[model samples]
Target: MYSKNVPSGFPRGFLWGGATAANQVEGAWNIAGKGISTAEVVKRSTNRKDFTMNQITKQSLTAAINDSSTTTYPKRRGVDFYHHYKEDIKLFAEMGFKAYRLSIAWTRIFPNGDEAEPNEQGLLFYDHAFETCCKYGIEPVVTISHYEMPLGLTLKNNGWAARETINEYTKFTKVLFERYRGIVKYWLTFNEINAAVWGFNGTGALDDDLPNDQKMQLRYQALHHQFIASALAVLQCHKLDPEAKIGCMLARMQTYAKTPAPLDVRAAQLQDQLNLFFTDVQVRGEYPNYMNRYFYDNGIELKFAADDEEILAKGKVDYLSFSYYMSTVTADDNNITKATGNFALGEANPYLTSSEWGWQIDPVGLRIALNELWDRYQIPLFIVENGLGAVDELTPDRKIHDDYRIDYLRKHIIQMKEAIQDGVELIGYTTWGPIDLISASTSEMAKRYGFIYVDQDDEGRGSLTRIRKDSFYWFKKVIASNGREV
Candidate 1:
């Protein structure tokens, strides 16, 4: 079956590309028509015992976490993509990128988060950026809102907690759709919409470290708001230009188990319900039975406004896009592998090595995820983010030997090709952090994910130089051969 399923190559017009988010890549943190974002308040700490580093970490371990509320310091230049986009896009074009996936900063458009009018300066910045990509025959795929929301709106209205957030989000999307309708044909309403289940902090939820009843409330409320907003944005795109295609981007987290035990099986099922269920509603226009039952049993009823259901039905997305990184093993009581002293939550994989940041490497899991997403939605799938995050060292001669990243991408591409041959209607493959950006989860400079490396560090000091790694040339060959050469 595996041999018969291998594809000779991708379809002729299949898009080959890479992706990045505005907040992570486009530093200028508060410059050039950009407004303050929650990321602005978010800070990263190296020493776990530093009390001054509040928003990014709360523990006494020497690691970083996003504790944004108390971290008063601003984010340092996050790769400075805002000013260096021309040079970066040129490199992408040189690599033969057919499509480039990026997001528009909402704060840049509506500085204070929401306004009756958008800042022309903000719109003009993208106008040039997208037009530049078009000039080189690279189609720009835009995510209207990434992880960073306007700090003004989030802090004032509690972000997606209030219904007003839907209105605010609509305001931003309405203008973007109308303005960039022709130049940017592909659109994602939100980046990782289901990530709210993790929470408001960097983990995309309120408390990833510990769970509480109130966290569930916050999660549900935030999801409800985003669902409504996404539905409305889809409708807006269609109304503004019926030819436009809008998608809801999600984090397609692949969950597995240390062993095929009953509890491990149940744990995996629960995660599918928790993660994929959110996208199910947006793509299928209805919630799955397991998700509905869980919500009811947990006493977490989702409230929708009067026109919410109608809006959702009318504005159903044209496709589904997701980011697949690592796979996780789970078990009910963390007792699945007692003899090996391994726990359900996490343990070193005996069969596979991990990224420096600890995400499990499983290229085959990508193919499995592709099939699951396609089987469930029956809609086209666009891979919005997929890549290897590693520590890249720039030699004195300015050369980066990133064969590890090349290997990571090569294996993933092989699985993606296999998935396509299996009849999954995949649109494009965009490796996350195409040009190294700050890590969203760890908030570190060293955790890199890019074919083109950015010279920077965690302490916010570096030459801000860009150098193509070995993966850059390998990826170029992949794009040129359409998966046959690489």
Candidate 2:
């Protein structure tokens, strides 16, 4: 298949761009009336094991909040995107970005979760940012909350555990919808609503010392609240601007069976079912029946309001979007040699190679995932986050030759085109961290994912310069050619 081949190339007006999160990109954390966020409390960790819940302790979190050291908490520095967004957006425009997917920091607006008024300064920042995107002929695809929430919500409103966050999140969305309704047509309710199953990331400021069972219960309950909140956000967006579209995002860790054994196949099926439950509630407008048995077995009784089901049905997402970092293999046994993936827990596949961070590379898995999602849900799909994270070396000539990233993306894009040829109605593909920003899992700047290289390091040193890598030029051509040149 080549550029002349129909359905192999991207469709007309297909958005080619990049994605970043506010808590991971924007520094000036406390400068412009920004309230503390749970992201700020998350200390830096280079060790992959430390990226888990083990590192998030009362002692560590308390010190991170009080100490306020950018070196220790690299996310606090975040490549200084707050000051350099103009330069960054210019770079994106140069790369011919038809769209730029970025999230709004909730604390930036509310300062605290339970505020009566939004911070004017925070509102102004995004207002200018959106205007700049429009000025550069780039469409801004916005995410409401991307893995970070106001610390005030955790401390006071009890985070997502309490149903109060549903109303609070609606308030935040209402402000955003009303503020930039026309400029930003595409919206995502949450970055990865399903990741709540693996708790403590965005669920709020619950004590890390809680029992395992209690923690699981809290996460599901919080996820329930968010489902309602997302539904409410859908209604708000429609009422504010009928032309706009709102979608739900999933960290779609496509799962595979470790072997063809019946037990392994069944285990993988069960895992996939559980993973799809998040989108089921959002898209199909009700939780699936299997959840009843799972919840009963797990002692998780989700409380629901009288009108929750009605609200869910009324606010079905306009589209379905997701991030596909890597896929995993599941087996029936518990003691299998596990993959080094920090997020999606699974056994390593023998046929796959891993990145520097241990995430398996699976281009074919993306095609399978696209077919599965298209058949499962008939709505248009968007690959809002897909990229390679590797350590790049800048040559003495101030050039970064990151052909590894280019190869990774090219393979994924080829599979994406195959899926489109399979008749999957994919609308867009935005590679994650188009510019170098802090890593969400490890909070390390060294684990870079940008086509454009950042000058900063893990300790937050360097001039914070934005230099285009070899992948940058390669991607520029990819976009200009509409996925044909790659």
All candidates: TM-score:
0.89, 0.97
As a TM-score, model 1 comes out at 0.89
lDDT, candidates in the order shown? 0.76, 0.88
- Residues 1-486 of candidate 1: C-alpha lDDT, one tens digit per residue: 355545566888787898988877887755667777655555665632221223332241112224323222324367888889999999999999999999888889998877788989888989999988998999899998887777677556767777887788888888898898787889998887765755564222223354576668777878877888888888888888788789998777677765688877887789767878778779887656787778777778788778877877777899999888777766777554321110113444667667665567889989999999999889999988888877788889888999989888889989998999888999898888778887666567777888888877777677988999888998999999888986
- Model 1: lDDT equals 0.76
> To one decimal, what is the Cα RMSD in angstroms of model 1 from the true structure?
4.7
Indicate the worst ten consecutive residues by lDDT in candidate 2: 48-57
Quality of model 2 by C-alpha lDDT: 0.88
